[model samples]
Target: MDTKQLNYYAEQDKILIATDCIIFGFDNQSIKLLVFKRRIAPFAGKWSLIGSFVKKDESVKNAAKRVLTDITGLENVFMKQLKVYGSVDRDPGDRCITVGQYALIRIEDQDIELVEKHGAVWYDLDKMPDLVLDHNQLVEDALVQLRLKASYQPIGFELLPEKFTIPSLQKLYESIYQKQFDNRNFRKKIIALDILTKLEEKDKTSSKKGAYLYKFNRKKYDKLADAGINFKL
Candidate 1:
């Protein structure tokens, strides 16, 4: 139904309010974005964000969560709605207002095989192919928000593995900031956060002496971050 025909009681329930997701993943090497091919509908073969219509008795967040479960098969993941795209021609099907959100999930639990069944694929932000509709703009907006988020909060947890090395952290930060950092200063600043505890054992596979790994201490960081302790590196 178009937006014009939604006022009556019976027609109101049929109104479409959809949600599109910009799911982000980290590969320890570089950041990646998740996109899916349009299996059915207006743009049959074009790449697009994972999306679904708002369901009965479901809130906007619930609709997004259902999309996550239905498409990715991952639950209790990190997600937040970025904005709503309601351009008259945004969705060719009808007058649906699409809520665009960006989600961060651990790569290990990404269910790549299951999602691939729908032709869902991961693309590097720098080298992505042309997307359908305004989906590309949605992704750009989401990335800008993620970059800002990484500043005060260690949003990298959504991307990084459980146990990571200082080099891994540095590289992640560099990818988000798009700049090279002096290793010594980088370590100094990140260590100063006091949220990462050095492990006794090192990752020997990478080298002979190996690099010491660190784990994020969420309990401690939350307490400090609450007190407005700035986190930067």
Candidate 2:
């Protein structure tokens, strides 16, 4: 390295880069958030999202995944970058900028023991407690993204099991949007999308006649999505 280059680099501002994740899970009837009580200083014992400072050798996306895996013990889940929060005074301790990301997981698929070990709790979206720093804003942004994505794509399938009934799928959308959908209309729209495969089997737990089982046709969805078809619900 050249001495002049090193000298010029040393004169620039040094800032901290951090990543915060907003993990969302669906429990069939409602959407929930994974949060934990802060165990470190600067807000110890208060509710907060899973987060950590980006390591020198790790990318921001990897940092978020690492933090989520360390806390939830889950891997290969659906995650995406939301946006950056760089308010000058967002972090009281230092000049830190955070890249926000959101993840979607099936609530029943998580490792409960691991979550408990980290003191993480899943709270219903509408009933969550006050959060630390700008975390409240982070959750709001993630939810907005989730709803918008769900409107035009089958991203909500990430929160559902491999096999689910039409009613179950409808309930998931209703919960995400916090509104009730006409059962017949919802089913008609979803079926028209041609992205679901009807199975011979049925889920009998919900009714005497039992609801027929269906699986998301990812291949079909992808083909249609590429053609600019919207999966609005």
Candidate 3:
């Protein structure tokens, strides 16, 4: 170890880094964002995104994953880096920068007790409360990224269960886009994609006649994705 080099580097300014997650889920109707009330000063009791400071041995992605797991108790979910927010006054607590990450998880799959323990609440994306410290901007950017990715990838499936009706799937898309889609066209396009496996079972809850249940074929989607197929819907 070079003592001189260590001493010289020790004089540099130290900046704190944090990872804030924009967690999205579908509740069979609308897309929801998970947030909790701030527990500390400078915005205490205000809505804020779940986050954690990066540990010395962890990367920003890992920190974000840790935050997600702590809050939701689910892992290996769809997560992506949205952007880095380094505005000088973004954090009033300190000179800090935050790496924004967005994640998609099935609403029914999260740990309900854990969420309650942290005072986390799910708010509809369109009706979310104003978040603290530039967190609202983070949410806006994440939604844009989500819509763009859903246009080309089947990533929206992450927010759904294993088996779902076509109508329910259509509802999920409509909630994401915040608009109505033609029922016939949506069904036709989804079937043409050939990424779903039609099951013999039917979901009778939605209707007396029942709608056929389908599951997303991950292997088939992987092959199609590798073949440069686009899932624009």
Alpha-carbon lDDT, every model: 0.85, 0.92, 0.93
> Candidate 3 — worst ten consecutive residues by lDDT sum?
2-11
Give stretches of model 3 more than 4 Å off: 1-8
**lDDT tens per residue, model 2, 69-182:** 887788999999999999999988789999999999988888889899999999998899999999999999999999999889888999999999999998899988989999
Off by over 4 Å in 2: 1-8
Model 3 lDDT on a 0 to 1 scale = 0.93
Candidate 2 clash pair list? none
Better of 1 and 2 by lDDT: 2
Better of 1 and 2 by TM-score: 2
lDDT score at residue 136, model 1, on the 0-100 scale: 93
For candidate 1, lDDT tens digit of each residue in 77-172?
889779988888887877778899899987878776788787788787887888888899998899889888888898887678888999988988
> Each candidate's TM vs. the true structure?
0.91, 0.94, 0.96
For residue 144, what is the lDDT in candidate 3? 93
